[model samples]
Each structure stands twice: as structure tokens, then as C-alpha cells.
Target: MIKHIVMWKLLDAAQAPRFKAELDSCKGLVPGMREFEVGIRTEGMEANHDVVLNSTFDDAAALEAYVVHPHHKKVSAYLGTLRESRAVLDYST
Candidate 1:
């Protein structure tokens, strides 16, 4: 399986929820998507990022399809406007 994890630091902290919602909207967008989860930072957490996504795919191809999906692209583009930084990790487990 392929695990794709991402974290984002938003330019506007208030937009964290909106960003998470946008990420959640991409769930189930393609086949072989095993799991998808989006989380927002807590009120008092010592965190650098505002949002995090933990997703699993059956393989690299499935992960690629999810990445290139139209809805994913739209959300990603919108997120680009809101995020100050992004970190991603893709690995097999």
C-alpha cells in the first residue's frame, strides 16, 4: 500500500477549516483509494501546520490518479492561495 501524508501551513489561520473541507471533498474521487482523513489543528496545539491529510492508496498509480483528479486539482489550486507552506510524504507500509 502507499501512504500519502500532507501538512499545510495556511497564510490565514482562520481558513484552516475551509482548507480541510476542501481536502475532504476529494475523498473517494478515484478507485483504489483505501482511506482518507483530514484534520485541523486544535485550539492550543503547538503546531506549525494548520491542516493535515492522511490517506492510503492501493499503489502508486492509484495515488497518482487521485492527485490528478479534477476535483483534487481544483481544491489544490484554491489551497495554493491560502497556504503559506506545504509538506508531503509518500511511502509504502
Candidate 2:
């Protein structure tokens, strides 16, 4: 399995909800997608990024498919406008 995690610092922190909504739209978007979860920083919590995407794929191929999927491309394009910085981590487990 592959664990794919992404953290984003948004241009406006208050847009975290909007960011999460966009990420959520990609849930179950491709074959072999095991899990897809989006999180926003809790109020008053210690955090550097405003939103996160925690996902699991059956394998590297599935992860790659998710990356190139059209719906994902659309969401990503929109999110690109809303983010100031992005960080990603992918590992096999």
C-alpha cells in the first residue's frame, strides 16, 4: 500500500474549508483508492499548514492514476490558486 499525504498553506487561512471541500471531491476517484480524507486545522491548534489530504492507494500505479485523473487535475488547478505553499509525502507501507 502507498500512503500519500499532502499539506497546504493557503493564501488565506479562512479558506481551509473551501480547500477541504475541493479535496473531498476526489474521494474514490480512481480504482484501488483505499482511503481519502481531508482535514483542516482545528481552532487554536498548533499547526503550520491550513489543510491536509491523507490518502492510501493499493500501490504506486494507483497513486499515479490518481495524480493524472482529470477530476483531480481540475481540483488541483483550482487549489493551486488558493495555496501559498504545498508539501507532499508518499511512502509504501
- Candidate number achieving the greatest TM-score relative to the actual structure: 2
What is the clash count of model 1? 0
Query: Per-residue lDDT tens digits of candidate 2, residues 1-93?
Result: 999999999999999998898899999999999999999999888999999999999999999999999999999999999999999999999
TM-score of each: 0.97, 0.98
Q: Residue by residue across 3-29, what tens digits does model 1's lDDT show? A: 999999999999988888888899999
Off by over 4 Å in 1: none
What TM-score does prediction 2 earn? 0.98
Please give the distance, in angstroms, between residue 39's alpha carbon in candidate 2 and its true position after superposition: 0.2
TM-score of model number 1: 0.97
Instruction: Tell me the whole-model lDDT of each prediction, alpha carbons only.
Output: 0.94, 0.96
Query: Which candidate's lDDT is highest?
Result: 2
lDDT of 2 at 9: 96
